[model samples]
Target: MGLFPISVTVVEPGRARTGFRKTAAMRLGSDVGPHGGTPIGGLRAYLANPAAEPPG
Candidate 1:
């Protein structure tokens, strides 16, 4: 008998100019400025840029 491997993959939604992004950005505000080397910073950058790609 042979066993077959199962493969699973997860995907994140693409970026869109939804108001939610703006609200989230406002909530983050200066309290969490883009650190330039962290996940939050990536999020800030993503939120700031309308064409920026989402983090993987």
Candidate 2:
């Protein structure tokens, strides 16, 4: 048995600056508690142009 078109690559990410944690807290109807993460916007860049070459 073989899986077609299956590729997995590991990525070393820097400090995560997403507000995912904060958003989850709000979903529970709780006050923001010492949130300290910035929006890295890395995904946004890729979404803008999937075929474009990555910036150096």
Candidate 3:
């Protein structure tokens, strides 16, 4: 992957139950997660609504 496609996610220090691993596991694949195809769709979706459950 190119540098342009890479992204960084920042989490607040000392936050509890942040679900960092769940968000990190999300793939940027066309058929993966709720917001599919688009680049970094999972992060975008999570940011939009953190309380929303991730697609299994």
Candidate 4:
């Protein structure tokens, strides 16, 4: 088994417009998983931005 490195980033609009509340945005690293990494909570982030390249 190998261990890979992953990162998570969170972005927020910090403002409301058009009578709508702005929600926070989140971003994750490209390399986010091991050979069989199973990120339970991270599923959303991973889905938001799937990795296009393999870890070096």
Worst 10 residues of 4 by lDDT: 16-25
Q: What RMSD does model 2 have? A: 13.1
| TM-scores for every predicted model | 0.49, 0.28, 0.26, 0.24
Tens digits of lDDT, candidate 4, 1-56: 34867677999854333311112113433345563255533554534443522233
Global CA lDDT computed for model 1: 0.71
Q: Which residue runs does candidate 2 get wrong by more than 4 Å?
A: 1-9, 31-56
Runs in model 3 deviating more than 4 A are 1-13, 16-35, 50-56
Per-candidate total of colliding backbone pairs:
0, 1, 0, 0
Q: Give lDDT tens digits, candidate 2, residues 1-56.
A: 47787879999975544555445434544322343132424333333443543433
TM-score: which candidate is best? 1
Query: What is candidate 2's TM-score against the reference?
Result: 0.28
Q: All models: lDDT?
A: 0.71, 0.44, 0.56, 0.40
Backbone-clash count (model 2):
1
Flag regions of model 4 displaced more than 4 Å: 19-56
In model 1, the runs with Cα more than 4 Å from the true position are 1-17, 30-34, 53-56
Angstrom error of the Cα, residue 7, model 3: value is 36
Candidate order, TM-score descending = 1, 2, 3, 4
Itemize residue pairs with steric clashes in candidate 3. none
Candidate 3 similarity to native, TM-score: 0.26
By lDDT, the best candidate is 1
* lDDT computed for candidate 3: 0.56
